[model samples]
Target: MVTYSRAALFILVVFGIGFAIGSTNLPGAWYAGLTKPPFNPPNWVFAPVWSVIYVLIALAGARTWERAPRGPGMLLWTAQMLFNFTWSPVFFTWHCTGIALAVIVAMLLAIIGFIAERWQADRAAAALFLPYLAWVAFATLLNAGIFLLN
Candidate 1:
């Protein structure tokens, strides 16, 4: 169903912001220099995976906002976004894998909190985050393993 409503605009704006942030934080020279585990995905994989994840995130956020404006879930959502924005900078820009793991862990927890709290208000909204939650879980493990290996 095509939507041209406020929620659609909100989701598009969120997606644009997320896309900009992620595009600017690409793992350039600093990431290439790092040691990687055998399971590390090829560099090309991240963009597609994160693109889908970001769409899901935008949908989840817009759903939650539609259900409850200025609510606790929104706070959790903001917290997750804050920490989400930190991971790439910490890992790629700062070259601090360990700190990046911490950042992802916090982001994961915030996603969980957002899901849990959001579920009460909008089950569909909470359900939308399941994929994001799963991805972050995988990312947290990957980050942890990278930190330990390198």
Candidate 2:
């Protein structure tokens, strides 16, 4: 079983890195200038939603890492995290929404693969990633819609 304190620390680190990455290029004029889709969430909604999602993702990562200790599943998890980290820089910082969509899609695929790979080692690990997959899938569509609308 994974230690709760260690798991909590892992969550904090992951979310901190993610939050830091996201903090650099906020929804400034560049974002305001874009043609957002009707379904695009209001500016106020993202923080709460992403805060929850990041915690879930961190839990998934920490649990999987503890269970498998850098196995193929962890590799996929790392891939997903990389893709996760890349999107904000591409979209918000570089203003490359199209490329961000691609990154999100890749993240979605990586999460799916991670789910499959982790399932064998720990069902809880696989289960933990489910929400991350779902959110990314939704974000993929949102990204696509943004790219299309813009």
Candidate 3:
């Protein structure tokens, strides 16, 4: 059985990875340069929401890893995480909202596949990804809107 400390560490690591990726000085300054949709969320909301999602993602990954250490499901999870990590830099730092939208769309599809695969291994793992998936779907639409508005 995986100890609570390991699980906590896993979550912290995932959150840290997200923080590191988003920590680029360019994002905060560059974000101000972009034209955002009126519906765009306040800047402060992103960190908190993403923080929760990252924790969920890490927990799901730990659970899935415990069940199926070397499986396609884990690969999909990793792929989605890679996509997640890349989007912030692309959109916020590089100001490539269109390309970021494309990346997120692909990411949403990959996460769906991950959920489907994880469903067979651990239902809780699959369930845990639901909020992340939903958030990404909303994010994809937001990305598209931002691209259009800007």
Using TM-score as the measure, the top candidate is 2
Error of 3 at 74 (Å): 0.4
RMSD to the true structure for each prediction, in A, is 2.0, 1.2, 1.6
lDDT of 3 by residue, 7-43 (tens): 7987988988888888862467567777777777887
Kindly list the per-residue Cα lDDT of model 2 for residues 4-102, writing each as its tens digit. Answer: 986898788888898899888786898888887777778897788788878877778788778776689889988988998899989998989889998
Give the Cα-based TM-score of candidate 1 against the true structure.
0.90
Candidate 2: segments with Cα more than 4 A from true spot: none
Prediction 2 global C-alpha lDDT: 0.85
What are the per-residue Cα lDDT tens digits for candidate 1 across 10-104? Answer: 67876787777777777898678767777788988888888887777777777767666688988898899899878887887788999999999
TM-scores, one per candidate: 0.90, 0.93, 0.91
lDDT (CA) per prediction = 0.82, 0.85, 0.85
